[model samples]
Target: MTRRLLLSHLSLMLLVLLVLEVPFGVFYARSELSRFTHTAQQGALTLAEVCEEKMEHGLSTDLPGLARAYGRRTGSRVSVVGTNGVVLADSAAQAQALVGRNVSAEPDIATALRDHPVAGTRSDASVGGDVLFVTVPGGSDDTVPCVVRTVYALGPLKAKVHATWIALAALGLGVLAAGALIGFALARSFTRPVRALERATAQLAEGRLTDPPTTDHGPPELRRLAASFTKTASRLQHLLQAQQAFASEVSHQLKTPLTALRLRLENFEPHLAPCAQDSLDQALGEVERLGRMVQGLLALARLENSAIRPESVDLGAVVADRAAIWAAFADEQRVGIVVADAATDVRVRAVPGALEQIIDNLLSNALRAAPPGTAITLATATAPGEGGRTPAMAELHVIDQGPGMSEAERHKAFDRFWRAPDTDHDGTGLGLPMVRQLARAADGEVTLEAAPGGGLDAVVRLQRADARTHRQRPGGSADADCAGNARPHGVMAARGHP
Candidate 1:
């Protein structure tokens, strides 16, 4: 797989090289041909001028001498032609073809007769082929006119251009090969680090972060990632060890009271008076409280050991159901309970039971601290951000109008067994901590703030459900809107009717 990946990258690089170099090679070859044509034309014209001088003197007066001299000087075939297109003097065709013979139909010669010397490249069988032809008319005073023509063979130029093309083709192939090699090296360099990281993550998932990794060589980012994974693994190992220790200690602490409560119950038949029964009931309540504490401790341990799985839930109904259960307890304590009607349809994504437990714990704590006539405010709604289409999330706030905690107390509120110093009320003091654990486990968060005027306020925030899962039922109450006391909140706000 790795080799295939590297080869794929190399192939792409080679393809790009081909795209850029092919046209450039063709264009460069054409440019060299153009330069060759220009240089040949200039030399041919110079030879034509000299040949015209020889033509003016005729055959007896050094015509061959001048033509031979001109041909030798310019490296071209020099010839003279009369106005009737007959070859008069020649340098290459053995200077003997001096008779009248019409040769005006030749493309290059005919063009030069009517216009400036028609200098261009042409290929022919005789005279070493592929030559530049140039013809110029010459006379003394426009009375007797003759044309001098020169042909410079471009065989050497063509040979050099062909050789250059071969060399460039080789160079282009080399460049493509070199690019593929470089690309292969780079792909290997990049993939090696990622493959190492993948193996490390697999080990970590299997709880094997106790030892360090073997290979630590790669780019800086990969090195940093390895370091981070090692650190995380170390921390997780320590945390698991700590949780096991805590679980053991908590279990030991709860066992003695549980044994004592069971013994007391077993021996209670001998003391069955009304007053004795009442005292025994009070002892049983204490035993139940201890059991609840142990259960909460187990829940906390499980939270540390487990991972979060988030899903949609309606918090409004969770609050209302909790309020209903606590309403009976609230009445017994002479406290007024009010579950706000407005939150009946609000919903958010979270663990269903965990969120309910958080709500229950917070409400239980609030009821303990709240005054008799004070109302506990349970509200649910969606929170809006600065900009964008979707609302941020759904929020559920449980407010109590009791005496609020000090800043110091608020900070310590979620700590296990760290209740406020002033309160003489008996409790396991694990309520708030358990609430926090459950909130975090549900991929949600919990915050404590001062209630309106003064009191404890517990707020839970979570993501809203997708639109497909949200449906409005007109006559439905909070009970029906939420599944198991959890309902939708963030969606209700998005319809602009919040």
Candidate 2:
């Protein structure tokens, strides 16, 4: 969460910098070029005035020396041209040879000779690059009309502009770095309370009570939310404790009476006449079924009352082990427990022993309904997502070749103590509800489907260990796929609808 927040902050900062700095840098570059051109033109006009004064005072003999001195100081090529298009003086090394050369066709010199200023850029071979030229009319009263021309190389000006752009880019980068640091700090501050709330919620779902986050020193809204959540969790904790205590008390209160009733009825078994023996048997059966129902309810209450977190489980290994244990019992009834080869290598997140209990209940239910010489198949497959919006899930199917329920019955099966009207086998119907709760505890789900071969399919869809959050219990195996992978094993005593 912090990373996402920081990235969003930095992205906005970069966009702002680009919007502002890009135009500013472009404007500065163009403005710098304009100012450099203007300065050169002004300098050329001043030099022209100096030349006019020297010519009017009869100092034309030192014209070349004046031009040379000006060029040396300003890093420019200076030239004096006569109105008749002859070179009067030049600052170049060949000035002496070109002192009287006719240069009237030269564009800048010709324009200046006609009394108009010349200012712009053009390619210059002598400098091996572009140059800025400024020419101005000078000394019209001289024996020969004259002009002054100045040529300055643009390399240094362009270099300065490029350096300024680099500086702006560097400054933008520094600002972005600073923004990232500040954004990270701010994101952490806000998400600290969120993290605490998440952990507390998970604990509360697992039947544990936890205090709300106290270090919620972030925004005012988050602080208020924390306080409200803490209050609600506290209230819920009290309610759960009271309910658990009630269930425990009720179980304790009824156990002796139920046991005594069953025993008292059995004591009458030998004394009762043989004609009334059938009545006695039915009475005993009802008491025994009632006792089982009570135990099933207590199992469900305990399942809800305990605090337990889900972790990664090897779906393949679990199915194989459970199937093996149930195989001997299945064989005695002329039924088979088959674990499909495709069921291997499946890892999913589930409540610690919830898969075993789910499997056992489903298998026990299947065994009761399945006919002799039939097989119960344990299969697993990966369920694909819908357009990548839904995450993939690991599906464990406990399939039985037995009488299947209709859609309405399947829908009602998950309800506590619900059984189909036609069901003849003894079951309290707590198993499906318990199975669903266990699946949900791991952020998964469960459903009942009619098998293609006209049987029941108990489909448990669990989160793929990699697709959802999970943590290994201390000392648990690191890899669930290894041949020697070990985990705690147990069979919970709860049977499903037959």
Candidate 3:
């Protein structure tokens, strides 16, 4: 963004400089040329007047000497030509070579012979370079009129013009440089405030509600925006806190009545008819389902509202331990639970109990969905670090040989209270949502994909625990290691029911 801003500023400056400098340079060159030409013409006219006085007695014998003297004085070539196109005298050339040489072929001399003063520029072999010439009639009698011509070197005039242009070009470059420096400073001033806002926004997204940025710096618009953002963040933080508190209180309040109703129904069950007893049992089941839902609601509120500090967890050991706990239940349902032996220890950073809850939810859903004689596989592997700057990630995959969801269904599977249609299993629809929420809270992610040969693969990716953290923990005991630690209290005590 800064580069783009700088380029845009420089481009505009260059365009403006070109617009102003190009025409000014052309005009300056033309003005200098005209001034030099006019000066040469005036000098030739004055010299013609002087020669006219001397030639009143007819073309003087010492005219060549006079012309040579004038040429030396003015740094120009002077020549006298007769009306008959014969050279009378030459200054820069030898008199013997030019005494009778016709110069009437030259445009300036021809014009002067016709009694008109003329000035022009052309290449001249006698001058050995291009020269500017001015010719004027010089004799008293028109019939015996002579032309006095002056030739000035064009090289020196052109050099002067070029020097002016070079100076102008240097000035233009200096202006552009100044403009660039000023533009960059201005751009930085504008972007500094934006960068600060960006950092504040990131902190807000990470649920850090403290230390809102001050609006005392930057442009007025940005300052107002920062102030507004601070107010909005405070309001949003308060609202979420209130909602979480309300939900927790309501869930806690509902639990006591639900438990009491269940006890009452159980006591009244033995005194009723068999049909009534079945109805009472159904009521008790419904009450239990409601109770589980309230518990889920409470858990969801807590997970969303609480900030959990992350710690290193051995992913492979966790998988093995979870698989072992679910093995008996899997056998009762005619399904097998398999834990793969990892080649290397895979560890990740997550909140305490976060990984356990994620595993329990996924395992419970898998057990409910897997068919008889099918196997559920829990495995851990290390994913390569992104850009090789971050540490490698630990991925825990739970593969179930069950009726997997379609692409469309998988997209909505994580929504609270959402469930697949036509499924026989009971679920509160909060399990996947809870799993996703907990994963994200730990700076991790969970995804569902169709497994090979028809099943669902639930994959969770978390940042790999640093080597220093791993070294700090007790090592070398499989059963008591990072993965095999005791389960989080009440992690899966209340199974989700729809």
Q: Pick the candidate with the highest lDDT.
A: 2
C-alpha RMSD values across all candidates: 11.3, 5.5, 7.2
Instruction: Give the worst 10-residue stretch by lDDT in candidate 1.
Output: 489-498
* Model 3, span 20-128: residue lDDT tens: 9899989988888799888888887777777766777775786788889989998888898866878878887654677787878977778888888888788978657
Q: What is the lDDT, from 0 to 100, of the residue 299 in candidate 1? A: 54
TM-score-sorted candidate list, best first: 2, 3, 1
The lDDT for every candidate, in the order shown, is: 0.64, 0.77, 0.75
Cα lDDT tens digits for candidate 2, 91-208: 9895579889898898878777778888999988889899988988875443436888888998998899889999999999999999988999999998888888787777666566
Model 1 misplaced stretches (Cα beyond 4 Å): 1-34, 58-253, 261-294, 341-346, 384-391, 467-498
Residue runs of model 2 more than 4 Å from their true location after superposition:
4-27, 52-59, 94-98, 139-144, 166-188, 202-211, 268-276, 311-321, 327-334, 339-349, 380-395, 463-497
Question: Candidate 3: deviation at residue 48, Å?
Answer: 3.4
**Candidate achieving higher lDDT, 1 or 2:** 2
Query: Cα deviation in Å at residue 12, candidate 2?
Result: 4.7
